[model samples]
Target chain A: MDIATVNALTYEDFVNVLGNVVEKCPLIAAAVWSGRPFLTLTALEAAIREFIDALPESGKEGVLRCHPDLAGRDLQSGTLTRESREEQAGAGMDALNSADASRMARLNQEYKERFGFPFVICARMNDKANILRQLSERCQNERAVERARGIEEVKKICRLRLEALVLTDAANKL
Target chain B: MDIATVNALTYEDFVNVLGNVVEKCPLIAAAVWSGRPFLTLTALEAAIREFIDALPESGKEGVLRCHPDLAGRDLQSGTLTRESREEQAGAGMDALNSADASRMARLNQEYKERFGFPFVICARMNDKANILRQLSERCQNERAVERARGIEEVKKICRLRLEALVLTDAANKL
Candidate 1:
């Protein structure tokens, strides 16, 4: 949790901690492992750069598969782990209300029908209103755009997860 | 380009035309109305829920903005037209090598020193190498977390121009 504590981790330790995150998301693992000679920070960064570049076509579907459908009242029951659900739900259920919940469910169905996947986004940081607005607006995007957007969203989610996982010291060093 | 033509644009057009990707330094923006949305569709998506619940800290920043540092690299020079040299440089420099370029210089320094924007991700259906690599490695971020992840990146850039000025459909819809 502390920067000093995280910084103290050996490169192997660092990799081990990150391994959990990578395992949960293959795109992330691919990005981390892509390219060779992890000699310097810059080189490591280059590997990341390469991964980001390649994500759209190659990694989009893989990342999408990691997400779960966002429907039903039991927000806790979806693909999100308990921690993720708690973090995302926060005090928003009351805010979601009945109409919002129904809309989310309907949109969820339409989204799946069109794109063959649940509507996924990084809800950890957003509030109820913004999430609702985005869901309604994004539903309007053509199936293609929304599909591609879905992959990008997954990458952003991973980026956030990565950010949270990074030690404060390593973060500062960067 | 006509709306129909633009709307018909495939993944490439979506990124090149709608997303306004840069030719060099995929992350750098030459001017206003250039560069990708800060939050990927997926990231924005997740944030949408949080936004609905509480309006995440940077939800406002997710709007969009013009790059100040990209002023000098304008393709046409002097004129600051919507389609001017500066603007073109910001939007069209996606392919430029990041190794040695003033844009990258300003982007890296200003982005890191200012608020730690680890270069936004757009995945405009182009070469996935750069984006994939960035996504993987950027996971190890802290400061870059807020600026680089989710809708924050888009919000930072959106301030430069109004929605009406860039996205025709969004403008009309709004």
Candidate 2:
């Protein structure tokens, strides 16, 4: 869909397509829908990013919590929203051997214990090796840094989702 | 799936299948899973109801908030969880005429404005007339009454999901 098509969307159509762009936080899309007729797909994403950044710290944590843990129970259960399952599978999460799966679970748990939110990365941008390494390394960061890190990763994921949903000029990858 | 099969599922698989039985509040299933080896499908539901009943008022309200409106945006956007889509359709929610759809949307907005949560009914159990009537009548309810009323509907929905998942003897409808 082009920016014109995107700008033409009714609130309901826009939310349905981009609601999960931020991973179960359609409220973001709902909140940003009022900022329609975006000059470019970039502006639409910027609006979403602003909405997320404006949330209180607890609200930010809540947003992160909305995300399923990578390779976690939702994946095992076939309960992942279609977008998440595809992203995780793209990163080879679905093919983890037992030992690696157990390791990922442990790291996810420990990270959540320390930071009170899941360790989020743009699964489409990182393969199995990078995701595991980041989880291990980021465990040592202060809560403040980890929180920002998670939010930034959320933006990365958000951009990829937007690009997939909205067409842009060659110079501006939506 | 039978009672024996339910009892045999590992925690992950159990949660995956039943996680959404309570709409988006998988935490309820996660909480109830501690009481394993349910002797009958009834026992499993009883365990779930007990857990829900134990939640404080705010938690109960949160559970209600997790529900999509009866014929609201998620339906328009195709974002309703599969279970919800089916439930609403089962009750003819998807077949609303323009007049009724607008009325339902107006009632939904009014209900939320007044009560801070969507007007909820077990769609599988109530067709359009009954659902609309209940919404109108229930709008006049005290918050406490509506709260309890909402929880009861959730339980009804829960029971249907449970029965659909777990087969039982003729004497015990799961």
Candidate 3:
């Protein structure tokens, strides 16, 4: 849909379409609806990023916590939200060999223990090998730095989601 | 917390505290935060209901779809969000017999098949037996009727959650 179509949407329709753009945090989309008549897809995205960036540390962690663990149980039981399923599959998370899956599980557990939230990267932007390496490397970053890094990744995921749903090229101009 | 304390929370704090009041649908809490400085707990809950009741049929379904299945894998694996885990346990869902657990699984699957959303009842307001009975009976409801019933159950769940988090007796005045 065009930016006008997106801007014209009622709150419910806007939320229904863009709600899951930020993992399980439909709250962001719901909050952003009040800022409608977004001049372009980039403005819409900036609104989303601003909301996330303005949250307190605890709220930011809550947003990260809403994400499912990479290659975790929800993926196994076929119960992941559609966006997550597609994104995970795109990065070969759905096809991990037994060894890779087990290693992923171990790393994920350790990551959560340290960070109090899931290790989030934009899966569509990276493949499995790179994801594993990043997961391993990021696990050692200072907690505050890692939290900021995770939020940045969330923005990347959000931009891609917005591109797919609304106008594609507008965000690039920003 | 008292009404003043509840009302005084910043949007981030308000959402952090009450975000899961409607199961996984934090969008309701996020949207409700805009209406803050509530006069009383009753008004706070009314705001939540207003946001929900205003949703179109599909949005209502989207709210219901956010619920985890009763005694489903989330419970078995101990991965339920804190609010859901406590609510389910308060009704003794944590201790279902093997036979009952299997029956619940089957019924939940069938209910989803019929309604396109999980069977939802206020588990804190009903024991496992009543939940099962309601699930079985509601499974036969016309799709539209069942959807409404599920939303009412969500409201009941929301109220109980609000009572636990904010003032308790003020909502009874409504």
lDDT of 1 by residue, B79-149 (tens): 34343333334444434555534545454445434442234543232233453345445545665254436
Looking at candidate 3, what TM-score does chain B attain?
0.93
Candidate 1 DockQ vs. native: 0.02
**iRMSD for each candidate structure, in the order shown:** 13.2, 8.4, 9.1
lDDT of 2 by residue, A56-173 (tens): 5545665676778899988999999888999999999999999889999999989977876689999999999999999999999999999889999999999998897775332231
Find the 10 residues in a row with the least total lDDT in model 3 chain B. B165-174
Candidate 3 per-residue lDDT, tens place, B1-174, comes to: 788877766444566688889987765676666567799888999988987786655557767767788898789899888989998998888899999988898998888777667788998889988988988898889999998998999999999899888855333322
Q: Please list the residue runs of candidate 2 whose C-alpha ends up more than 4 Å from where it truly belongs after superposition.
A: A168-174, B1-174
What do the candidate models score in CA lDDT, each in turn?
0.42, 0.79, 0.81
After TM-score superposition, what is the CA distance of residue B149 in candidate 1 from its true location, in Å?
37
Q: What is the docking quality class of candidate 2?
A: incorrect
Q: What RMSD does model 3 have?
A: 13.1
Structure candidate 2, residue pairs in collision? none
Q: How far is A65's C-alpha from truth in model 1 (Å)?
A: 2.6
- After superposition, candidate 1 runs with Cα above 4 Å error: A1-16, A19-23, A34-49, A55-58, A71-74, A91-95, A168-174, B1-174
* Fnat, one value per model: 0.00, 0.00, 0.06
Looking at model 2 chain B, report the run of 10 residues with the lowest lDDT sum: B165-174
